[model samples]
Target: MNPVDKNHWLDGLEASVERHLQHAIYYFQNQDSEVLLKPSVTGGWSIAQCLEHLNRYGHFYLPAIDRALQRHDGQPDAPTFTSTWLGSYFTRMMQPETGKWKIKAMKAYAPPPNLDAHAIVAEFIHQQETLLALLSRARRADLTATRVPISIATFIRLRLGDVFAFLIAHDERHIQQALRNLPVSQDIDVQAVR
Candidate 1:
């Protein structure tokens, strides 16, 4: 994509991050630990667990994105970004629209039992803000030229645009999961067994 198009996409992604952050903050502030930490009857993840999973991804991608952007600092600007086939495929797989399609989390990304809800929420909020900053830095770089490796295999790299797409889509997916896990009632009174 051209500079204009890339910027427009980043704008939308940043806005989505901001919106997710707001909802997360609202849930964390308004809801108690009982609601946030309650697991599903089928042994699925809780709201805190979902946020922690996203945080695990952020831990990998945020630093990698920062390094990728830095590498493009003195390079000549490219007119357009072309997504790699593998990158595009991964991004498509992670999109929020596919939330109904259940995919098990990698072992490294799974949150443990009895996690601290406040800490997980705080980290997720901070990570979203950091992601927004990274998006701003991305605009200055050539999205097609900058490459970041995935967490599972550091040797494999993808274009910056695809990384952004994957990360944002991944964020949305988990946000949806967390939202679904939330208690409908404001006055939550469940004592969920771990």
Candidate 2:
């Protein structure tokens, strides 16, 4: 288990979100549309599709988080958050760690093919900004007590902190997934001539 600083975990996570925003910006600015929209080498989602998938989650989660925060408007933040066992399990499952495990996306979250790469990238940037704003709001609320409904089941709720952790980890997973899907350059041929 990683040590949690009582006062700084959310702030640290906010910083992490900022880093993700910057990374996405770099990708959008540096990568051409052809690269961004190319189908994965593994014949799965393209980079744009991966990002749209994240955006689709944002559409549900961001509003749900907003409502959760509003409902707990009077609650004070605890000195530290300790995630529920189930919440912790779900969060851990989404983390990219070694990227060895691949979970199939539910049908509802999958992005359609041939989406406009530029538009999808822009939407992702906007959503990340919205997430950061929500995290800032979260620091003043009881994150462990604030519950957001899971996308799969509206009745199944997780703590706000866990939701953020899961979403952030999920985003990282797809970002790396999209990067991996980029077509490999085959121009270099270094055959060993013995």
Candidate 3:
């Protein structure tokens, strides 16, 4: 991937986080437990499961990001962020638009059936807020120099900017999956929600 201005990159990511947060507030919060737990017509995971899955990831990445930021506290922010080859590969694989292959979730991250809709939605909202704050804090740190370990493999780490990119893309992928599981009668306007 080409180098991107740090501020511009963060701004785009922040906007994405805001949209996800708003959707959780306006849409998911309004749904009843039954609707939220309803499985897709093709027999996929429920909305609640999708969210819980994301929440599980947030449980790992959020703290990892915080720790990385703290460890690199005095570092200077770079003018631009250039994604590493591996980082770019991971980000592209997580993106819903570019990622056509459906990868199975790790056993730990896979959410089971019968999750509480309200709690899942609430946690998701909290995590999104936390992500926003971290993104803001990241302005003071060097995106290229900082590294965060991937949940799947602790020994391997990616640039802070790549972590943000892939993590948000993963969130979007599942959120869209969750939206698909929504009942047709609910008449959700996905575009307008953002």
Best by TM-score: 3
Itemize residue pairs with steric clashes in candidate 3: none
The TM-score values for the models, in the order shown, are: 0.88, 0.87, 0.96
Residues 1-194 of candidate 1 have per-residue lDDT tens digits of: 32446777778888878877887787664568888799965688888888999999999999999988887898876655687778777877888655456788889998896988888899999999999999887778888878899898999998888898889888887777677676666423222210
Candidate 2 vs 3: which has more TM-score: 3
- lDDT computed for candidate 3: 0.91
Order by TM-score, highest first: 3, 1, 2
- Determine which window of 10 residues in candidate 3 has minimal summed lDDT: 185-194
Q: Over the stretch 1-194, how does candidate 2's per-residue lDDT look in tens digits?
A: 34355348787678768866876786554678888888877788888998999999999999999999999998776767777788777777887764457789999998888788888899999999999989888878887778899998899999888888888878877876776665565221112100
**Model 1 spans with C-alpha error above 4 angstroms:** 1-4, 186-194
Query: What would the per-residue lDDT of candidate 3 be over residues 1-194, giving only the tens digit for each residue?
Result: 68889999999999999988987887789899998998878888989999999999999999999999999988777888888999999989998889989999999998889887899999999999999999999988889989999998999999999999999999999988888777777667665565
Indicate the TM-score of model 3.
0.96
Query: Cα deviation of 58 in candidate 2 (Å)?
Result: 0.5
Over 4 Å off in model 3, which ranges?
189-194
- What's model 2's lDDT at 95? 72
Best candidate, lDDT: 3
State the displacement of the C-alpha of residue 3, model 3, in Å, after optimal TM-score superposition.
Answer: 2.0
